[model samples]
Target: MGFEDLEPIFGEPKVEWDQGQDSVKLRPFLFHVSASDPSHLRIHVTDFHSNTWEAVKSVVQLEDMRDNIGIGGSWSEFVDYVIASIKSEDLKLVMEGHSSSGGAAYAKLVGQKLKGMPLISIPLTKLLDAAASEAMANLSLELFKAFKNMQHSLVEEQEQTFQLTKVISAEKERNETIQSQLDYYSKRQKFQKKNATDKADVSSTPMSNGLQNSPDKLKAQEASSTKVVNRVVPAYRRAKVRGAFLQDAEDAKDS
Candidate 1:
């Protein structure tokens, strides 16, 4: 809750505007005090930032020229006063906050200590009760809205987490496939190196050693030729060649 949040507690409070400052009128709050007598009470919205706690105040209007009165606190506290007045059966007890501070208190007490006076208690009591109920309703709505927003956030978070897990699993599978391919290629390279080295050594040997004209030598050469014709590439080398052929085919398709 911030500064504007005070509206629920204080109704709608506005900064006091000085008439001398501008002719335009903007009124949301008002406060006054009366002190025609010592027994009387009063309150006012003074330089609040500089002042200290004081008494309830009520301003004197023309009709009530009858002196001596009391007032205090701002209208924000008025509802409490009204409620208290109704409950305690005494208006003077809750005169601090109201539209007209001392007026509200005097209106409640006038008939009690004076004759031929009418009591105006019903209206104030009803107004205060209605205001309190409205404030409660507003608070409940705010809470419900907050709960809905929190639920939405939780659902969104769960969806995001599920998506992340799918991505991670896909990457794991891709890495495993790449590792398998690397192992296959590595074995093929080793087989190719060994075969090439053995062929080179055979080629460097003397072909005509004197035994070349012998019948056994002729048989050996014939066997050797047959072996070469029947020789098969290692499984690793065959697989490597097949992979290369497939890659080439894919590249051709793209072109």
Candidate 2:
């Protein structure tokens, strides 16, 4: 149907309504209905510029039939239309006025149908009475922001501490492993050195002879045994000293 035909159904307003006169005016209008204000006849004016952000999109931008619905391609209608795109695509007699427009926008934000929901507006435009209630709200918001920041910092510190602890533990374990390996190698080296010294002492000494003709041999043998004992005992003592040093190093690492 043409625009003229759909006008009467959507409250056909005069194209040139003269003030204080019944002259035809081109002002737009919408049908208002509410149980509380059944007899309220509020004329919808399309020329009232929307001060809200929703006043940018054209109604006909999304749907073709939007222009025919008497909203006059207003962005408010487009916003309400986008919101109602969830469900109830039909613009019922229920949708009307600035309050209803706000309701529609909120419903879309919450993704729920909240018809006739009581709005509790906490106006921050003025600090009327600074009571505990007022201070609590302000303090709560600030504390929450502070707590979030502190919690983030604390978590980072904890992570760094845990990493440091892990590194220290790994180092201690490495030191222990090195000490164990050192002990094994030191003992092996000490045993090998003692064996070599003993072999050398035996080769250097003369063979045993009869006691009647063996004074020189006896003296040589005695010297060789003393030399062997001297060589082996020093290596053993050195091995013990190295073990003590390694133990001290390990204890220092633990500390």
Candidate 3:
């Protein structure tokens, strides 16, 4: 229903009328309720500048009202059900002073519904303490998670660095081995070249010093000298034989 329907239970609500515009505005009011004894259960309905109405509209839209209130139940019954659902020992309502909106009489009538029910006021410091404790707890949890993540990242980085170092070291050892083999080959090539150069120098040095001889030239010079000697000796022998024959012939003629 409407606020006008609640006027029977909660006194008359303040109203403002504009005859010129033919419009009416209902002044906001507060409704307070509490149970008897010291159970600390209470409920406060404040509609200052229609703030309460706006909050309710945000939660329960017009289209979803049927689902929340049901087809047979009235708005008043839905409100009653919400109130009955709260356990007297489970909930505590915190009240604060509001600026006067000329609804003190309506609040007084609504407060009379539950006689001997006293308003249990909670201190502002206690609320602040509870809020600070919860905030600190949440901050600590976030910091713990951040530290854990940082530690995990550091471990991952360390592992990656270790693996990289291993690869680098292996590469270095391989490079060293390759370099050593290259050095060995280079030394062997240099030694072989030096030996070949030394042999060439030794062979050329004998030729440069005129110590190399040919055996065919020496044998040809010896045979030419022997042939000249044999021809001279045979000619001298023939000349001597002829001289002896002339002597013999001259002796025979003188006889």
Candidate 4:
């Protein structure tokens, strides 16, 4: 409850302790006692004052007290609990510290002391190790998440690329098919046109020749008929006269 209560158990502190005012330097530790609501007992395992970061000129401040030996409001209860924890003359206080619950730093204050020794030690190495482990864990988690995201994105990109390639290939195939069709159509059209031209030429050749030959045949027929008419009519009349003359000539001959 007060400094008086602590004096009996811990003896006169290495440094004089004031109630609710400041800390008491107890050898290698600094003891903080709070009398207000949410009363706490903070024991430093390191010399925080000596390790204070330099602020302005002559203004130094302790960045991290990091001194946690024993905590909680009931000192008597913890004292009794620690006493009861002694099994077979072995003063073992194996407390598993939790720094993650309530989203706050380590809640349990941890410190050490040897048997029959007035000195309490706050191992800075252990706390720093814990802090480092926490930091590393968080960093590892962040890195893992980042890598996972990258991997996911890479996979997605690959899938998209594959899909795009497939689409391109399909389009290419389609274009090729269309091009082939066009070529086929072009060749067919050319062949059709050539065939049509050839057919037209063949048909026109017969038509032209027949037209030329028809006029020649018609003129030949007219000439032959006219010549025959002229020769044959004269010959017919001569035949009649020549028959009479022949008859006269025959009679003359006979005479």
Candidate 5:
């Protein structure tokens, strides 16, 4: 089958016309399938950079698949198997170079060349699937941690509120107790003042009542007191009178 036959399986390919090399390149053609590393699939078709052969021969290089293409299976079956194998395994990639000392030397010389090239070639569908899964996993973990932190913060806030409520309640009760004591003392003070006023009124009542009931008797006593204070006694009278009893006795003796 031609490279065009692979279009239905691998989708449209990007074509590169190399004018200098006079060879047309089509990608992403199946290049290699790793026996050990299933995810390490490579998609590149390499041939001599010449245009002498037919286009089919140049583009579809069967020699490249001699190792991986099974003896009895078709190309479609082999491609399907490679895709299935990659999906079933975890996503990873591996790279290899030509087994030559010059290859190592050349790699060292060109250390940063093609630095960002992907080591493995997977279908776009598989790559997107893997990326989506990893993103979801990371997002889920972050959400879980955030939820736990929110729960902890909520609990702490509630505890603080409870404590504040208790303090407020205690203060309110204490204020009420102080107000009760002040009210009681205020009432007692008012009662004591009223009692002292009543006693004064009672002590002055009897004298006021007696004056009102018997004003004449009080005036008489006042008059008597004034007479005694103003009264004067006369001095004794001088009197020399002979006793009649002495004369009687003398007459009797002469007889």
Candidate 6:
């Protein structure tokens, strides 16, 4: 009729620890506190089950259940109470249940959003199967399957790594080729610039020398032209004088 009667068939509830209020606790472990005065509250401790003991334990932990209980048959209200209780932030739910409590405890750890820990369930049924299976039984084939899968994964990872290595090596070779080409181009540019400058200097030197020589050549040509003009002017003056004298003699003879 009661848990005591059922204890023989089902294992007794496991005992959990309480670190007190204001400390962080995980899920499934409920603590109740009651207050002697309206301003104060008392503490009750138990699991989160609907058992009679849990009901009594809740009251002992809290002054009243009015603030913690849900409206009749209201799933939403019950969930709200549970969520509000956790939000108190001052209360902690210790994880301490075993077997039947395992599911509840694991849920609390996960539901309360505990960090750095995950729930692990090792069912007794599975444990028995694993223990009783023959060494060569097909029942344990899952191990072989997992091993083969792991091997495949390793092969894939190795292939990916090799591909990455080849890609990196190719990139390095390309960079080297580009660098060599750049260097070659830079050297060629410098050489071409020097060659062009040298050609310009050689061409300019001859043109400048020719330009300088042109003034002297012009002076020599001008001097030769002046000498010829002077000689021609003297000869023309002598011819004029001879013609005038001949005219004067003819006039005298006519007179």
Candidate 3 local distance difference test against the native: 0.42
Best by lDDT: 3
Q: What lDDT tens digits, residue by residue, belong to model 6 across residues 56-103? A: 122233322334432343433443443344334333333333334232
Writing each residue's lDDT as its tens digit, candidate 5 over 1-255 gives 323323211111222332342242332211222221222232322111211011112213333442333323675554454344333323222212322321111111001112342222332212123443443344345446667888999999999999999999999999999999999999999999999999998887778677757979788889999999987754455343566444578798998
- The C-alpha TM-scores of every prediction are 0.33, 0.31, 0.35, 0.35, 0.34, 0.33
User: Please, what is the whole-model Cα lDDT of each candidate in the order they appear?
Assistant: 0.41, 0.38, 0.42, 0.40, 0.41, 0.41
Would you list the rank order by TM-score, best first? 4, 3, 5, 6, 1, 2
| Residue 151 displacement (Å), model 1 | 1.4
Segments in model 1 whose C-alpha atoms lie over 4 Å from true places: 1-128, 208-255
lDDT of predicted model 5: 0.41
Pairs with backbone N, CA or C atoms under 3 Å apart (clashes), candidate 4: 44-67, 45-122
Q: Write the per-residue lDDT of candidate 1 for residues 18-115, one digit (tens) a residue.
A: 22433333333222222335333322222122211123323233113222223245533433343233223222321222233211211112112233
TM-score, cand. 2 vs. native:
0.31
Q: How accurate is candidate 6 locally (lDDT)?
A: 0.41
TM for candidate 6 is 0.33
> lDDT score, residue 130, model 3?
45
lDDT of 4 by residue, 97-199 (tens): 2233211122122233435432232222224445534433443454466678889999999999999999999999999999999999999999999999998
lDDT score at residue 242, model 4, on the 0-100 scale: 40
